[model samples]
Target: MVNDDPRVSPEARTRVKDAIDALGYRPNIAARSLLLGRTRTIGLLTVGSTAYGPASLTLATERAVSNTGYGFRLANTVDVDIDSVENGLSLLLDQGVDAVIVNEPTSTFRHRRHGLAIPVLSLSEPLDLSDVELVVGSDEAGGVKEAVEHLLGLGHATVHHIAGPQEWPSSKRRREAWKAALEAAGRDVPDSIEGDWSAASGYEAGLEFAKRPEVTAVFAANDHMAIGLMRSLQRAGRRVPEDISIVGFDDVPEAAFLSRALTTVHQDLAVAAVRGVELLMEVLDGGREGGTIERVPTRLVVRETTQAPVASS
Candidate 1:
């Protein structure tokens, strides 16, 4: 009856249902899983509590999970070190999750699942983990490549970069792509400024840029840093797109309305999250092999922050 066997008498099913309805009984999902050997639940581990990418991806995963008729649990962490990740997953597993999703693992993240018995998926930068079933994220390298190319097409002499922490896979990919784009075009590869994906760090880099009049174009790894860089430039009396052109990744909500609208790379965070969960489902279905990475696409978003460099009279 629990299996809903078609051979079971329909009247018998109705009687059991009526009895349960009369008693107002509800099946305990966890207990039911114990009996059936499948929980149909997924655990999610998000990177930062307030970071834009992780936050948006979290919502996407939740929506996707709901669509799949599965329950979920979430854990948020600021630290992405291997030990911290292990602890986070341990907590989720204690909740009896049948599967797990690591929302945004840093590049420096080391994989050690402590002999995890269930399938593992990640919505972070694609790190080919031998033990993981699926890894997925936006094509950060492609996005940055496009962003840099766009700025170069605008007649800028060179496009500088403000990158996220070096430890992060996304930041590293973007940084490498930016460098590769510059080299491919025979443009000088300038040293990149490092940021913590925070406006404060970008502002710090901006403070330095304000002193260098040679900087005409810049690409920031994320939108928050872009906002910081722009605001800093404004304070230094440098006008965006007029005195300095800028491009950022991750088209955050307010990017369009910023004082001088932001030009950015639009990463479909929600789509990536949905894809990760879908991949997880495929893995759980037992036909797909592990180590597959699905790359979600990203596009360039032109806005007021980018333009052709002003010609010197």
Candidate 2:
């Protein structure tokens, strides 16, 4: 009756429930796991900076896990190196999680093997490793392509890019997509300024861009950087959409509330996170296999920040 075993008679079960409610009894998780041979818990190993995207994904995943009636454990590592990833994984494994979700977005963990007994899901790029059971990633390329095409369609001569750190797979995918969109449209592909996914870096890039009259349009990797870039451009006496236009990725909650109402890419991290949990459940239930990669689509939300370039005198 305590474990809710169906063998108990209705009268006994009712008595047990009434007594339990009276005493406010709680089940012992460790003891239950010992008896059932499962913890019913999901572990998440997140490796990277606490950027808006990653941080939101973590929270979304936690919510998804809880909604599915599973316990959630999280171990975070600031560094993207292999050692940090391994340490984080070890910490989660030590807690006896039934499955693990790896959110390492760096190149180092993309194909690495983690010889774990339980199922593994990766929320970063798709991995071909034998140990990883499933992969769920946002459509980094699609959103970037849309943003670039929108800029070009607005009559910008060429769209300059402020790319995120090269180490992250998401950054690489966005940068590649930006370049591919320009090439496909027969537009000149300018050199990209690499940012560390930081507003400071974006502001720095904007300072340089402000001096270049040829830079009529810009695509920032994320909204935070876009905000910073817009600030710098405004400080330099360049009016957005009049002298220069900007588009950003990751349509954050604050994007719409900005002074210019940023035009950006909207990728729902919660959708991806929920799908990841569902896939992991399938794997645990022996219904899904490893090497399954899922990409959630993104869309462009055009707002006030982007427009056709003004004719130069």
Candidate 3:
């Protein structure tokens, strides 16, 4: 009644507004929710930095979510499996989140959700969840393909791969892309080495690579493994780019600053994050439904770690 009522004097309205401003009056969220029927909050469920890819995506999503004028609640798990994902979702629902964003969705995500209490968006790799919206991660496949192709272009006969854990969707994408790239070039897809996305696993793979004098090029799934591989190579007396060339995925903070400066796939974490939150918000507003995945782009960054293999005379 105080708003635009003919009988209400402008001076009185101004006085009340000034007084409220002076008092720094703020609305109670609970009371506001009762009126608007929306909590204006988001729930983030993620494994969160257990690996390079998920960690980067989570940090980016958090910043984007905050900038969008909505509060966010997060449920993080140490072990990313079906049960852990379900537990995080239920917790967010219990707390009355307006929507959920699955930041670290696993390859097994389709088997995890029985249903969602609110709109759900996933910062995902490829998935078969037809009813759920996916803010697909940047073109990991294309980026990895470039990494592989770069090695082939440098005249490597075949390239070895030290891949991340097979259960993760990103790991699978990178691995499959590597295989396809090799096959497309009519090069052999050498036996792949599996890493747990750890430096130790990469170091172990490095040991194996050092034993193969003919292995002239290699790609590791992420930077940690790549760094480890480099260390192992140095220790084994195999010079980088001279004896073997290496490529890594996920251009993390220190990629360019390392001793050998890693060549890697550059994905904009902030872009992925912003898109995920925006998609979740759109879903909360009933703006869009599922059956589609939006992909952000990715590219390859070349640095000191890679070069043309030493040509045999």
Best by TM-score: 2
RMSD of 2: 2.9
* Global lDDT scores for all candidate models: 0.84, 0.88, 0.81
Model 1 over residues 1-313: C-alpha lDDT tens digits?
A: 6568898899999998899899998767778677878888898877765768878888988999889978978877768777776677668888888788877546434455243677778776544433656888888888888998999999998899998888777788889999999999999998899999999999999999999989999999999999999999999999998989999999999999998899999999888878888888887778776788788999999989998989877
Q: Residues 130-201, candidate 2: write the lDDT tens digits.
A: 474788879888899999999999999889999999878888889999999999999999999999999999
* Candidates in order: C-alpha RMSD to true structure: 3.1, 2.9, 3.5
Q: Which pairs, if any, clash in model 1?
A: none
Which stretches of model 3 miss by more than 4 angstroms?
1-27, 48-50, 109-114, 126-132
What are the per-model numbers of colliding residue pairs?
Answer: 0, 0, 0
Clashing pairs in 2: none
- Candidate 1 weakest lDDT stretch, 10 residues: 106-115
Give the Å shift of residue 43 in candidate 2.
1.3
CA deviation > 4 Å runs, candidate 2 = 1-32, 110-114, 129-132
What lDDT score is found at residue 252 in candidate 1? 97
Candidate 2 lowest-lDDT run of ten: 106-115
In model 1, the runs with Cα more than 4 Å from the true position are 1-28, 107-115, 126-132
Query: All candidates' TM-scores?
Result: 0.87, 0.89, 0.88
Best by lDDT: 2
